[model samples]
Target: MVLWVFGYGSLIWKAGFRYEERLVGFINGYSRVFYQGSTDHRGTPDYPGRTVTLEPSHGEVCWGVAYKVSGEEDEQIALSYLEVREKQYDTKVYLDFFTDPNTTTPAVSGVMVYIGSPNKKLNPNYLGPASLEEIAEQIINAEGPSGPNRDYIFQLENALLEIGCEDKHVMDLANAVRKTLSEMKMDS
Candidate 1:
Protein backbone atom coordinates (compact mmCIF):
# COMPACT_ATOMS: atom_id res chain seq x y z
CA MET A 1 0.00 0.00 0.00
CA VAL A 2 1.04 3.56 -0.77
CA LEU A 3 -0.20 6.73 0.87
CA TRP A 4 0.31 10.36 -0.06
CA VAL A 5 0.27 12.86 2.78
CA PHE A 6 0.12 16.62 2.25
CA GLY A 7 2.11 18.99 4.38
CA TYR A 8 1.30 22.69 4.35
CA GLY A 9 2.71 23.75 7.72
CA SER A 10 5.61 22.37 9.77
CA LEU A 11 5.44 19.22 7.70
CA ILE A 12 6.87 21.10 4.76
CA TRP A 13 10.17 21.80 6.49
CA LYS A 14 10.11 19.15 9.18
CA ALA A 15 8.48 15.96 8.04
CA GLY A 16 9.91 13.78 10.81
CA PHE A 17 8.77 10.50 9.34
CA ARG A 18 10.37 8.39 6.62
CA TYR A 19 8.92 8.60 3.15
CA GLU A 20 9.88 7.11 -0.19
CA GLU A 21 9.17 10.19 -2.32
CA ARG A 22 8.43 13.87 -1.86
CA LEU A 23 6.64 16.12 -4.35
CA VAL A 24 5.88 19.82 -4.21
CA GLY A 25 2.27 20.52 -5.04
CA PHE A 26 -0.84 22.59 -4.46
CA ILE A 27 -4.29 21.65 -3.17
CA ASN A 28 -7.34 23.46 -4.53
CA GLY A 29 -10.21 25.44 -2.97
CA TYR A 30 -8.34 26.37 0.16
CA SER A 31 -6.28 29.33 1.30
CA ARG A 32 -3.77 28.93 4.09
CA VAL A 33 -4.14 31.27 7.07
CA PHE A 34 -2.56 31.67 10.50
CA TYR A 35 -5.76 31.03 12.38
CA GLN A 36 -5.12 27.80 14.28
CA GLY A 37 -3.94 28.15 17.86
CA SER A 38 -0.87 26.11 18.72
CA THR A 39 -0.95 25.46 22.40
CA ASP A 40 0.96 22.22 22.18
CA HIS A 41 3.66 23.03 19.67
CA ARG A 42 4.50 26.72 19.47
CA GLY A 43 2.96 28.02 22.66
CA THR A 44 1.14 27.16 25.85
CA PRO A 45 -2.53 27.01 26.77
CA ASP A 46 -2.09 30.26 28.65
CA TYR A 47 -0.48 31.87 25.60
CA PRO A 48 -1.24 29.95 22.45
CA GLY A 49 0.66 30.72 19.24
CA ARG A 50 -0.80 31.08 15.76
CA THR A 51 -0.34 28.41 13.10
CA VAL A 52 -1.57 27.71 9.58
CA THR A 53 -4.97 26.18 8.78
CA LEU A 54 -6.92 25.92 5.57
CA GLU A 55 -9.86 28.25 5.24
CA PRO A 56 -12.21 27.33 2.44
CA SER A 57 -11.97 29.86 -0.36
CA HIS A 58 -13.12 29.35 -3.88
CA GLY A 59 -10.46 29.64 -6.60
CA GLU A 60 -7.73 29.40 -4.00
CA VAL A 61 -4.68 27.17 -4.06
CA CYS A 62 -2.42 26.41 -1.08
CA TRP A 63 0.98 25.10 -2.08
CA GLY A 64 3.00 22.67 0.01
CA VAL A 65 4.71 19.28 -0.11
CA ALA A 66 3.31 15.81 -0.65
CA TYR A 67 5.18 12.87 0.78
CA LYS A 68 4.71 9.36 -0.60
CA VAL A 69 4.87 6.64 2.03
CA SER A 70 5.16 3.15 0.59
CA GLY A 71 4.92 -0.29 2.17
CA GLU A 72 2.16 -1.22 4.58
CA GLU A 73 4.40 -0.96 7.60
CA ASP A 74 5.82 2.42 6.58
CA GLU A 75 2.37 3.83 5.80
CA GLN A 76 1.05 2.66 9.17
CA ILE A 77 4.01 4.12 10.98
CA ALA A 78 3.71 7.41 9.14
CA LEU A 79 -0.01 7.67 9.78
CA SER A 80 0.38 6.79 13.44
CA TYR A 81 3.10 9.39 13.88
CA LEU A 82 1.05 11.99 12.07
CA GLU A 83 -2.06 11.20 14.10
CA VAL A 84 -0.24 12.08 17.29
CA ARG A 85 1.60 15.13 15.90
CA GLU A 86 -1.45 16.51 14.14
CA LYS A 87 -4.00 15.82 16.85
CA GLN A 88 -5.22 19.39 16.71
CA TYR A 89 -6.21 19.08 13.07
CA ASP A 90 -9.66 17.54 13.58
CA THR A 91 -10.48 17.06 9.90
CA LYS A 92 -8.73 14.87 7.39
CA VAL A 93 -9.58 14.97 3.71
CA TYR A 94 -8.21 13.20 0.70
CA LEU A 95 -7.97 15.59 -2.20
CA ASP A 96 -6.41 15.74 -5.64
CA PHE A 97 -2.90 17.14 -5.63
CA PHE A 98 -1.68 19.35 -8.45
CA THR A 99 1.83 20.44 -9.24
CA ASP A 100 0.66 23.82 -10.54
CA PRO A 101 -2.19 25.97 -9.33
CA ASN A 102 -3.33 26.54 -12.91
CA THR A 103 -3.18 22.88 -13.83
CA THR A 104 -6.30 21.35 -15.36
CA THR A 105 -5.49 17.85 -14.12
CA PRO A 106 -3.98 16.59 -10.91
CA ALA A 107 -0.63 14.84 -10.80
CA VAL A 108 -1.83 12.74 -7.87
CA SER A 109 -5.22 12.01 -6.45
CA GLY A 110 -6.56 11.10 -2.99
CA VAL A 111 -3.80 12.77 -1.08
CA MET A 112 -4.51 13.01 2.65
CA VAL A 113 -4.54 16.46 4.23
CA TYR A 114 -5.12 17.34 7.86
CA ILE A 115 -7.29 20.41 8.34
CA GLY A 116 -8.11 22.55 11.36
CA SER A 117 -11.43 24.29 11.14
CA PRO A 118 -12.58 27.74 12.28
CA ASN A 119 -15.41 26.32 14.32
CA LYS A 120 -14.46 26.51 17.95
CA LYS A 121 -16.42 23.40 18.76
CA LEU A 122 -14.56 21.35 16.20
CA ASN A 123 -11.16 22.93 16.81
CA PRO A 124 -10.75 24.15 20.37
CA ASN A 125 -7.43 25.66 19.35
CA TYR A 126 -8.88 27.86 16.65
CA LEU A 127 -7.57 31.38 17.14
CA GLY A 128 -9.67 32.72 14.27
CA PRO A 129 -8.84 36.04 12.54
CA ALA A 130 -6.72 38.83 13.84
CA SER A 131 -5.05 41.92 12.36
CA LEU A 132 -1.57 41.41 10.99
CA GLU A 133 0.06 43.32 13.81
CA GLU A 134 -1.88 41.49 16.48
CA ILE A 135 -1.04 38.10 15.06
CA ALA A 136 2.60 39.09 14.66
CA GLU A 137 2.81 40.34 18.19
CA GLN A 138 1.38 37.11 19.54
CA ILE A 139 3.76 35.09 17.39
CA ILE A 140 6.69 37.20 18.50
CA ASN A 141 6.06 36.65 22.21
CA ALA A 142 4.88 33.03 22.32
CA GLU A 143 7.03 29.97 22.95
CA GLY A 144 6.29 26.37 23.84
CA PRO A 145 7.71 22.85 23.83
CA SER A 146 8.40 23.07 20.11
CA GLY A 147 10.19 26.45 20.08
CA PRO A 148 9.49 30.12 19.56
CA ASN A 149 6.42 30.90 17.47
CA ARG A 150 8.35 33.43 15.42
CA ASP A 151 10.74 30.69 14.40
CA TYR A 152 7.81 28.69 13.07
CA ILE A 153 6.77 31.55 10.82
CA PHE A 154 10.34 32.19 9.68
CA GLN A 155 11.01 28.53 8.98
CA LEU A 156 7.74 28.15 7.12
CA GLU A 157 8.45 31.24 5.06
CA ASN A 158 11.90 29.95 4.17
CA ALA A 159 10.59 26.47 3.43
CA LEU A 160 7.97 27.79 1.03
CA LEU A 161 10.60 29.91 -0.68
CA GLU A 162 12.87 26.89 -1.01
CA ILE A 163 10.05 25.06 -2.77
CA GLY A 164 9.77 27.90 -5.32
CA CYS A 165 6.32 28.87 -4.11
CA GLU A 166 5.53 32.30 -2.73
CA ASP A 167 2.52 32.55 -0.47
CA LYS A 168 1.58 36.18 0.06
CA HIS A 169 -0.17 35.48 3.35
CA VAL A 170 2.91 33.78 4.78
CA MET A 171 5.22 36.48 3.42
CA ASP A 172 3.14 39.31 4.84
CA LEU A 173 2.86 37.71 8.27
CA ALA A 174 6.55 36.88 8.33
CA ASN A 175 7.35 40.53 7.55
CA ALA A 176 4.97 41.67 10.24
CA VAL A 177 6.57 39.33 12.76
CA ARG A 178 10.02 40.64 11.86
CA LYS A 179 8.93 44.25 12.21
CA THR A 180 7.20 43.52 15.46
CA LEU A 181 10.25 41.77 16.88
CA SER A 182 12.47 44.66 15.80
CA GLU A 183 10.19 47.25 17.37
CA MET A 184 10.05 45.27 20.61
CA LYS A 185 13.83 45.01 20.71
CA MET A 186 14.21 48.76 20.12
CA ASP A 187 11.67 49.53 22.85
CA SER A 188 13.61 47.30 25.25
Candidate 2:
Protein backbone atom coordinates (compact mmCIF):
# COMPACT_ATOMS: atom_id res chain seq x y z
CA MET A 1 0.00 0.00 0.00
CA VAL A 2 1.36 3.35 -1.06
CA LEU A 3 0.69 6.34 1.17
CA TRP A 4 1.02 9.97 0.13
CA VAL A 5 1.97 12.64 2.67
CA PHE A 6 1.87 16.45 2.41
CA GLY A 7 4.37 18.62 4.14
CA TYR A 8 3.65 22.32 3.88
CA GLY A 9 6.19 23.50 6.38
CA SER A 10 9.03 21.33 7.68
CA LEU A 11 7.98 17.70 7.26
CA ILE A 12 8.67 17.67 3.54
CA TRP A 13 12.28 16.99 4.28
CA LYS A 14 12.03 15.84 7.87
CA ALA A 15 10.32 12.50 7.36
CA GLY A 16 12.36 9.66 8.84
CA PHE A 17 10.88 7.07 6.50
CA ARG A 18 11.86 6.51 2.90
CA TYR A 19 9.42 7.60 0.19
CA GLU A 20 9.01 6.04 -3.24
CA GLU A 21 7.60 9.15 -4.93
CA ARG A 22 8.57 12.81 -4.66
CA LEU A 23 6.77 15.79 -6.24
CA VAL A 24 6.41 19.52 -5.95
CA GLY A 25 2.92 20.30 -4.65
CA PHE A 26 1.30 23.72 -4.47
CA ILE A 27 -0.93 23.73 -1.38
CA ASN A 28 -3.75 26.24 -1.41
CA GLY A 29 -4.78 28.62 1.41
CA TYR A 30 -1.38 28.43 3.13
CA SER A 31 2.02 30.05 2.84
CA ARG A 32 5.35 29.45 4.52
CA VAL A 33 4.75 31.99 7.27
CA PHE A 34 5.81 31.69 10.90
CA TYR A 35 3.30 32.20 13.68
CA GLN A 36 3.03 30.89 17.25
CA GLY A 37 1.29 27.49 16.80
CA SER A 38 2.48 24.95 19.39
CA THR A 39 3.99 24.32 22.83
CA ASP A 40 6.18 21.60 21.37
CA HIS A 41 9.92 22.02 21.57
CA ARG A 42 10.14 22.96 17.91
CA GLY A 43 7.66 25.84 18.13
CA THR A 44 6.44 26.57 21.67
CA PRO A 45 2.89 26.35 22.96
CA ASP A 46 2.41 30.05 22.30
CA TYR A 47 5.26 32.52 22.20
CA PRO A 48 8.18 30.76 20.53
CA GLY A 49 6.36 29.62 17.42
CA ARG A 50 7.31 28.27 14.02
CA THR A 51 5.70 29.07 10.67
CA VAL A 52 2.93 26.60 9.58
CA THR A 53 -0.60 27.42 8.35
CA LEU A 54 -2.96 28.58 5.58
CA GLU A 55 -4.64 31.99 5.65
CA PRO A 56 -6.49 32.25 2.28
CA SER A 57 -5.92 30.27 -0.89
CA HIS A 58 -3.99 33.01 -2.69
CA GLY A 59 -2.69 30.59 -5.35
CA GLU A 60 0.77 31.38 -4.09
CA VAL A 61 3.09 28.50 -4.98
CA CYS A 62 4.97 26.82 -2.12
CA TRP A 63 7.09 23.71 -2.67
CA GLY A 64 5.92 20.56 -0.85
CA VAL A 65 7.38 17.06 -1.26
CA ALA A 66 5.01 14.09 -1.50
CA TYR A 67 6.22 10.63 -0.53
CA LYS A 68 4.71 7.14 -0.83
CA VAL A 69 4.96 4.65 2.00
CA SER A 70 3.24 1.57 3.43
CA GLY A 71 0.85 1.52 6.39
CA GLU A 72 3.51 0.49 8.90
CA GLU A 73 5.93 3.09 7.59
CA ASP A 74 3.21 5.72 7.73
CA GLU A 75 2.50 4.98 11.37
CA GLN A 76 6.18 5.05 12.20
CA ILE A 77 6.66 8.33 10.39
CA ALA A 78 3.75 9.79 12.29
CA LEU A 79 4.97 8.40 15.60
CA SER A 80 8.54 9.52 15.01
CA TYR A 81 7.14 12.99 14.46
CA LEU A 82 5.42 12.59 17.83
CA GLU A 83 5.17 16.16 19.05
CA VAL A 84 2.52 18.53 20.37
CA ARG A 85 1.51 19.73 16.90
CA GLU A 86 0.88 16.23 15.55
CA LYS A 87 -0.91 14.90 18.64
CA GLN A 88 -2.73 18.10 19.63
CA TYR A 89 -4.22 18.82 16.23
CA ASP A 90 -3.34 15.85 14.00
CA THR A 91 -3.67 18.16 10.97
CA LYS A 92 -1.56 16.42 8.35
CA VAL A 93 -3.37 15.28 5.20
CA TYR A 94 -3.07 14.02 1.63
CA LEU A 95 -5.15 16.06 -0.79
CA ASP A 96 -5.48 17.52 -4.29
CA PHE A 97 -2.48 19.53 -5.41
CA PHE A 98 -1.13 20.54 -8.82
CA THR A 99 2.50 19.81 -9.44
CA ASP A 100 4.63 21.74 -11.89
CA PRO A 101 3.66 20.41 -15.33
CA ASN A 102 7.02 21.28 -16.74
CA THR A 103 8.92 18.70 -14.79
CA THR A 104 9.65 15.39 -16.53
CA THR A 105 9.15 13.43 -13.35
CA PRO A 106 6.25 11.00 -13.25
CA ALA A 107 3.05 12.19 -11.66
CA VAL A 108 2.85 10.75 -8.15
CA SER A 109 -0.11 8.72 -6.89
CA GLY A 110 -2.47 10.20 -4.28
CA VAL A 111 -2.46 8.89 -0.69
CA MET A 112 -2.92 9.81 2.99
CA VAL A 113 -1.04 12.39 5.04
CA TYR A 114 -1.10 14.03 8.48
CA ILE A 115 -3.11 17.25 7.99
CA GLY A 116 -2.66 20.13 10.38
CA SER A 117 -5.44 20.67 12.94
CA PRO A 118 -7.65 23.76 13.44
CA ASN A 119 -7.62 23.62 17.23
CA LYS A 120 -6.25 26.98 18.35
CA LYS A 121 -7.34 26.35 21.93
CA LEU A 122 -3.72 25.67 22.86
CA ASN A 123 -2.57 29.21 22.17
CA PRO A 124 -0.51 30.68 25.00
CA ASN A 125 1.19 33.95 25.91
CA TYR A 126 3.63 35.33 23.38
CA LEU A 127 7.14 34.93 24.72
CA GLY A 128 8.01 37.46 22.06
CA PRO A 129 7.16 38.58 18.54
CA ALA A 130 6.96 35.83 15.90
CA SER A 131 10.08 36.90 14.11
CA LEU A 132 12.98 34.80 12.84
CA GLU A 133 15.15 36.86 15.08
CA GLU A 134 12.88 36.16 18.01
CA ILE A 135 12.63 32.43 17.33
CA ALA A 136 16.36 32.12 16.85
CA GLU A 137 17.03 34.05 20.02
CA GLN A 138 14.61 31.89 21.98
CA ILE A 139 16.05 28.61 20.69
CA ILE A 140 19.55 29.83 21.37
CA ASN A 141 18.61 30.98 24.84
CA ALA A 142 16.27 28.08 25.68
CA GLU A 143 16.91 25.79 28.65
CA GLY A 144 15.01 22.89 30.28
CA PRO A 145 14.16 19.34 29.24
CA SER A 146 13.38 20.92 25.85
CA GLY A 147 17.03 21.21 24.85
CA PRO A 148 18.30 23.87 22.43
CA ASN A 149 16.06 25.22 19.67
CA ARG A 150 19.12 26.20 17.68
CA ASP A 151 19.91 22.53 17.16
CA TYR A 152 16.44 22.07 15.73
CA ILE A 153 17.00 25.07 13.49
CA PHE A 154 20.27 23.69 12.20
CA GLN A 155 18.94 20.19 11.55
CA LEU A 156 15.82 21.52 9.86
CA GLU A 157 17.90 23.91 7.82
CA ASN A 158 20.18 21.16 6.57
CA ALA A 159 17.34 18.82 5.69
CA LEU A 160 15.31 21.52 3.92
CA LEU A 161 18.30 22.65 1.89
CA GLU A 162 19.04 19.06 0.92
CA ILE A 163 15.49 18.76 -0.41
CA GLY A 164 15.44 22.24 -2.05
CA CYS A 165 12.37 23.48 -0.12
CA GLU A 166 14.12 26.05 2.02
CA ASP A 167 11.84 28.68 3.58
CA LYS A 168 12.74 32.24 4.46
CA HIS A 169 11.49 31.92 8.01
CA VAL A 170 13.77 28.93 8.63
CA MET A 171 16.77 30.62 7.07
CA ASP A 172 16.12 33.74 9.07
CA LEU A 173 16.01 31.73 12.27
CA ALA A 174 19.27 30.05 11.34
CA ASN A 175 21.04 33.33 10.76
CA ALA A 176 19.60 34.88 13.87
CA VAL A 177 20.67 31.92 15.94
CA ARG A 178 24.13 31.95 14.45
CA LYS A 179 24.58 35.64 15.13
CA THR A 180 23.37 35.30 18.69
CA LEU A 181 25.65 32.33 19.30
CA SER A 182 28.60 34.25 17.92
CA GLU A 183 27.80 37.24 20.10
CA MET A 184 27.48 35.01 23.14
CA LYS A 185 30.89 33.54 22.40
CA MET A 186 32.42 37.01 22.28
CA ASP A 187 30.69 37.97 25.52
CA SER A 188 32.00 34.83 27.16
Model 2, TM vs. native: 0.65
lDDT of 2 at 23: 68
- How far residue 184's Cα lies from its native spot in candidate 2, in Å, is 1.4
Off by over 4 Å in 2: 8-10, 17-29, 36-57, 71-85, 97-119, 122-129, 143-147
Question: What C-alpha lDDT do the candidate models reach, one value each?
Answer: 0.94, 0.56
lDDT for each residue of candidate 2 in 1-188, tens digit (9 for 90 to 100): 55566665556656656666666665544555444344555544443434354434475555566666667767577546544435533444545555764653535544444444344444332232466666666676554234455666676677667766666766877888899889989999
- Tell me the spans in candidate 1 whose CA falls farther than 4 Å from its real position: none
